[model samples]
Target: MTTIEELLPDDLLETLRGRAAGYDEDNRFFTEDLEDLKAARYLTMLVPEEFGGHGLTLRQASQAQRRLAQAAPATALGINMHHVIMGMAYTLWRRGDHRLDWVFEDAVKGEIFAFGISEAGNDAVLFDSVSTATPSGDGGYTISGTKIFTSLSPVWTRLVVHARHEDQLVFGFLDRDADGIEIINDWDTLGMRASQSCTTKLHEVVMRPERVGTHTPLGPNPDPLVWGIFGAFELLLAAVYTGIGERAVNLAVEIVGKRRSHVKNAPYAHDPDIRWQIASAGILMDGVVLQLEKLTGDVDLVGTGEEPQYGGKWFLHFSGVKGRATEAAKEAVELAVRTTGGSQYFRRSELQRLYRDVVAGLYHPSDNESLHASYAKALLGPVRE
Candidate 1:
């Protein structure tokens, strides 16, 4: 029952916000913020109570992410990768699958888990991988491939990766210092700079059999693992972007209320056009947050032993939510920037940073194009693949 409000005390949240600009300016990882989060037990929020965590449900965790994001989007997002993987393991364990219990236990004990599944041009999503997972005959796998956008690159203790093994798509965690593991710190980017989501190269990195978690075939299937990952990742990601939108709207409101219009001798908030624009952003943000609450709340209810009512529809909903929320967040940020005028374009402005950060959402899975294609398939029946 530990809310984000409790975990991130007001003073800590202020300190984090105060440092966000410095981290973004240096294009460095939010090392100080990460340590603060760890100390606050934010990293272990989703782990089970028996494992020394707050045992927050996914719904609660999603809210926590949103609140954290409102303070520091990049920090919240970078750490969200860890939460997504841990949420998956804990969820599976709660649903009577104990295979990934070790992952949850370690996470609760303060182990940092980083996501390492994305690859260049491998848009098969989770169904396929460009990396290879060659069996080492001792039941282990010798993984050899590069993973791009590997978040938490500098400090991950365990990396959850997905790669191909003949016809099967293998997935599991590996020690950060495992042989052949290399981290390339070339994370210069437009937004989420503090995330330090860099490139991870694996040159025949070896993983023990115990480390390999799941092996599903290379295509769409009715695997709960797939559902769990997609659900947690998409929903939590949406929440983070939504937080950005929320913050942007609030900032715009504050700035507009203080800026005087030269002709009218009144605040910009008095202008009908300015009020309408900020209102539109607020409305869009409201819709995104409502959608997140609806979907995550449903998932929480389903976790109580009932059949998954959403089924495949869950993924569709997630895709829609993620795509829409991201777009909405981007729109909100853009509006905030416009409302603030030329002053926000500077590197020192938080709105400028947020505007860039929101763009990163467009690159995540369920991009606008992909979401449209899926919607077409869902609504009008599938075209020839």
Candidate 2:
């Protein structure tokens, strides 16, 4: 029964909020925020209690991530990469797939995990990889390719990556200190600047037999590992953006209550148009909240030995939730910006930073086009050849 309040107290959140602007301005990693979260053991929230973690369910973890995002989206997103890997491992283990048991054990020992799946020009996503996984004579693989958007680059001890091994997609873990691995310090971005998601080049980096995890076919398939990854990644990503929307709505209410409309001789909160904008944002957020809750709750049930009957609809649920939440967040932030008046246009304003951060959601997996296509295919079969 670990509460989000206890894990991220008001004082800690305030400290993170206060530092957010500075980190954005300097484009540096949230080192202090990471230290604070580590002290609270936030990184191990998905690990079981026996492994020295909080043993939180996916629903609880999503709620905690939403709370954290309210204070600092970049920090929440940076730590989110670690949580995604842990969540996948936890989900698989809960379903009696102990292939990733070492993930939980290593996390308890304080080894941070990072994602290294995204690549340049790899539109096939998890189904295919631009990187190569050449089999070694010793039953391992030598990976060589560039991985973009490698979050937690500054602190991760282990990196989970994927590459193509002929007709199969190979997934494995690599130690940060492994030879032939190079981290490029080029992560300058429009928003989520504090994540430091730099580019990592693997020059035939060796992954021992024990390090390799799962290998699947070249295209989409119903592998449990794939299910675990999609479920954890989409849900957690939605949680973070939904948090941004929540923060935006709160800021709008606070700002409207304080600012007065001279023409109306009253606070902006009393103005019908301003009130309508805030209310509209709230209405949209209400649906987003419900969607997140329902989806996360369903995933949690799977941990208790409940069989998921989603079938192909699981992808629809996963991508649909993320797509809706992110787009709604952008609209909510826009409403907040419009309601807050000219001051929010300043670079120093929190609303301005949120405006920048929210856009990054558009580029994440299951982009709008892909999401819509998935939904269409689900509803009315795939496009005929």
After TM-score superposition, what is the CA distance of residue 341 in candidate 2 from its true location, in Å?
0.7
Stretches of candidate 2 exceeding 4 Å from the true structure: 303-305
Models 1 onward score TM values of 0.97, 0.98
Candidate 1, residues 1-385: lDDT per residue as tens digits? 6766898788988898999999889899999999899989889888888878898888889888888898999999999999988778866876788888888778877789988988999887788999999999988899999899988988999998889988998888899778899999899998899999999999999888999878899876657777678878899999999999999999999999989999999999999988889999999999998999988877776557664576567778989999999999999988888887788888888899899899999999978888898889879988877
Consecutive 10-residue window with the lowest summed lDDT within model 1: 302-311
* lDDT score for candidate 1 against the true structure: 0.88
lDDT of 2 at 332: 98
Q: Could you give candidate 2's per-residue lDDT for residues 119-192 as a string of tens digits?
A: 98887677799999999988799999999999889999999999998889989899988899999999899999
Ten-residue segment with the worst summed lDDT in candidate 2?
301-310
Q: What is the Å distance of residue 176 in model 2 from its true position?
A: 0.2
Superposed on all Cα atoms, the candidates' RMSDs to the truth, in angstroms, are: 1.3, 1.1
Specify the highest-lDDT model's number.
2
Among these predictions, the greatest TM-score belongs to 2
